[model samples]
Target: MVKKKKGRSVKKNPNVNLESEELTQAPHSFIIQRGLGHGHIVELTRDFRKLMEPFTAKSLQEHKKNTIKDFVSVAGLLHVTHLCIFSQTEVGMYFKVGRLPKGPTLTFKVQNFSLAKDVVSSLKKQLVVEKAFKRSPLIVLNSFNSDTAHMKLMASMFQNMFPKINLTNVDLNNIRRCVLLNYNPATDLIDFRHYVIKIVPVGVSKGVKKVIQGKIPDLSKCNDISEFFTRAAILSESEMEDDPNSHITVNQKLVSRGNVEQGQSAIKLTELGPRMTLQLMKVEDGLLDGIVLYHHHIHKSEEEKLEIQKKRDSKRKLKEKRKQVQEANKKRKEAEREESKQKSLKGMPKSTVDKDSVEERDDDVQYYREEVGAEPDKDLFLDNNQTKNDVSKVLRKFKKKKNENFCKNKEDKFERNKQKFGVKRTTQFKQNKSRVRNRLVGKTFNKKSNVKRKSK
Candidate 1:
């Protein structure tokens, strides 16, 4: 038997906090698809992940068998704060935005959606590999300053989904992408749009812009570079004018050229779609459940509200009572376990228990001595030397002899059987081995049989 080496026991202190502020405060999300999602829905999920950028699980592969608990199990370890779950049903597509651990879940019915590929296909020219998604996108919430509790709560929740931007230290060059959530009060819908921010110089012809951007103009048809610009009939596609409303004067220097300080720069938005037209359906407390905070389709009377409040109160009270009971039961079991452990330790062979108990390991002797109110004349325990001698004597007695009656009865029983039946016990051709088997094994019939005939 191998002996086990005892190692040092270490206990962790729960109260001592060691996490940094950035990890605790920064918002991280997991965007997942539940149920059956395919085709455009899967592409749309990928687009949404791109929009979330660096803080999200980019390469996360979710299994169909994964439940909510699987994600929740690691949420705390990863400091994930939000869950964006997309699921499809017979009714339509649904989008759920839930806060982790506990939540006031927001459910939106996707009225319509357009994938990023569809947008790129529709556009004549658009930048695809721009490093805009390296950092988080700038969140722009428009017309969300509503006075209602749910509206304010939603606005706040959206704000918290991204890291709190420091205006003073923020780099102007890093803000390359923007996410717009425009709420239309008239339709009760939110228009979601993602765009790549570009700055083009104002009043510059596309030809001149191309030349300045290091693109060699088509001078093969012209004698010189000046003639390429001089040809009146050779009006290139570059002469088309741009939107005047987009022209804005640059306040700061940028990493991308054409946006000079104190110079006019036309801000352009190339829509990087996976666009969604979402209508608010419902909002509930504690992760898609627990309590209904708001409902667009449902309305209730004052009496109904009061009844709901009472029921909620009753449920809370019952939950608290159950929690208390469970805690008490756990403590009681722990105490009982500790007490039994101590008792077993005290009654151990090497412990302060009596010598008789250590030798024989029986508690009855101790009780007998207590009952008599004195130590008995004879010890209940046998000495080591005497006990060894007694054990050897018993073993020798058991090994001494076999019963003579057993051998005598065997022959008597065989003879009685032959006399009772009145039949002759004759040896016949009782071949134990088959002819084929005997030939294969090289055996002969003349060989002596182990069985002996009875003497006359």
Candidate 2:
């Protein structure tokens, strides 16, 4: 038999936690800001309302209201204009609060000026790439939400222009025709490109706001307005990528939902009560069309843990069953061994032969004594009482039987002789008579012969 190595097998706990501690940390940010441009903000808000209307149809309107309120609470209105107000400030001095998703939320003193400069340069690239000189305003998309195929094609086209980039998260939004790029000097950030288009309010004069709003702002120029904001907002977002500990902050408003507490940059009890907590986190790069952020829990792997536990329990049960079967077999083997011993002991001469031999000897002695006592001639019969009696009885029976047999044989012989020949008694009488007659004749003849001789 080959000897097995006595190495211990390590068993893993399936319930071991897979979620990182980074998920537990709430979103932290250097600043908090609300968007400006109240009318556009309201329009965005209306868009959110329309999105949530469908969700409310499934339940009491309160459900939808809570969701909206929660998103606003965590992401802080989720209005791009509001977020822009903070972007206007210098890069270092933090002001507004930002929500982080899967990563950590951090508070940092703005340490680098190049980070701000990079943001501006990233935005400038958008206009140049889109070729904004044309009438049909170009559309720019952030690398975050770009489709893989399109991203790859774009990457190939721009291989000589820029480094390789991944566009796995992209999907075409309401706007079309865009360039996606990753441009972050401090932290790698996704960016979208197009000529900056600004929507001028009905009342505002054509000045700095108008200049920022761009040349043409109208329904026909809606696409342009979208592209302009896409570039302007590029610099607004400040994400910390160096700190594996840091996460991007975002608002839930774009998706038209409430704030999340578990994975967001900040964790806070809702105004409603302790029943729920509001969470805020960034979902994607700022230049991406969709709002950045989500609300979810740091969920535990419950099902896997239960499955592991069940497996262990089943293995234990199987082991116990096998042990029971082995024990029963052992008992049965022992019982068989015991039974075999009993069988061997049963035929032992000590009990079957010796035990009975002793009894039989004693019985023989008693039988002899009884025979002696029963006999009348005790002295003569003592030595061979049984043998003598047997012999005498046999002789007497033989003599009596022999006499009976002789009589029967003589009768049978006489009967057979009478049948075979006539009687002999009359023969003797006839013979005597003949002899007397013959004697008489001879005497007469003799007298006659004497007389004749005298006469001569």
Candidate 3:
């Protein structure tokens, strides 16, 4: 039996990285539906991620336990510029686009939306390809020329979501997708759609175009080559009727052949959608919070606005005062630490002064050493090795001197008694001399207790 060879694994290319100068400067965002999410909203977030494409965090897997702050905290390090949050409520689905760190957030009520899979399923042919999303989609805005401040801001934000193109040096082949934002003044609603760009030959029939495209269609149903031209329905069902508005003569070559000629090329767009219809509900001055700049549903009186502003000012001032107090305390602690450290270092070299004070009484020993040049008597010095000189060590030295005198006197008396009493009396005197120290200590204790001892 022959062994089958294992197929080689194909590694997917990494997403647009940090080293790319153009991508780093461009606005990047995360489509987040953190915390709890409903079924439609979770799927909606997934579909919207596709619309963001290679520049955005395409592989960001958010947990229900995760929070907005978790993403916000790291957004600056990753150079993320914007945050898109989708949430569903009992009334409707809401979408928020907030600038990172500090933000003027735009909140929209999602009137309706269709997912990408649903859009593709409705079409006769699916044009969703991995190659189409390799580069960011071109953004085209319509009816955004209104003088309203919010409208201008919305237009600017939408434009910045996609990277800027330098048409002079940009490759035509990489321009594969586009996003269209059409605003309607009548409804005050925005229609958002994504599209895949395709350039096809206008003059040629579907059969010849297919041959040029290198896709060989089935010929079993066709009787002859002429039948392909004669039969109107025999061409692919996915083929769309050519629109005159879509046709444009190309000045340069394209990725596809036969569409490069000046008169032959036509640009067609297929809906690559997760289509959205949104109505701006509110606009905030900060990241999802702060002062409300505009609100479609709310109106406040002049007095109320003034009162709110005064309260906010008071709170801000109080916070700043507390911060100053904390800073002052921190500086005080650091100063104290430095002071203690300096005091310790300055006091480190005073050991010589301490030694001189401890041995003040030993001046005689030093004088003899210098003048006599002889070894001093060991008995003259006190044994104070373990600790400083104490009363106990002094008493011990006095007792040794006293005992020496007592021993000499007793020996002389015992020698006199021994000469008169003979050898037995001499042995008894020797034993008494051995116990003389113990007998002296007992006699002192007996005198303190007022007791008499019979001494022989």
For each candidate in turn, the TM-score is 0.70, 0.16, 0.70
**Model 3: lDDT of residue 135:** 86
Q: Sort all candidates by lDDT, best to worst.
A: 3, 1, 2
lDDT tens digits, residues 1-456, model 3? 999987654443354352677767988998988434666788889888888888789889888778789999989878799999998777788999998889989999999999888899998767877898988899999999999999988898888778888988888788899999999999999999999998888878877777788887677889988787567886555576577887787766786866754666778888988999999999999998888878899988888888988998899999999999999999999999999999988885667766865576478689878998996887565434424456767788899989999999999887888789988977866766756766777743224435667998
2 or 3, greater by lDDT: 3
- CA shift at 106, candidate 3, in angstroms? 0.7
Clashing pairs in 3: none
Cα misplacement distance, residue 343 of candidate 3 (Å): 5.5
- Candidate 2: what lDDT? 0.36
Reference-based lDDT, residue 55, model 1: 86
Q: How well does model 1 score by local distance difference test?
A: 0.81
**What residue pairs clash in candidate 1, if any at all?**
103-286
The 10-residue segment of model 1 with minimum total lDDT is 424-433
Please say which candidate is ahead in TM-score: 2 or 3: 3
Worst 10 residues of 2 by lDDT: 269-278
lDDT of model 2 at residue 279?
18
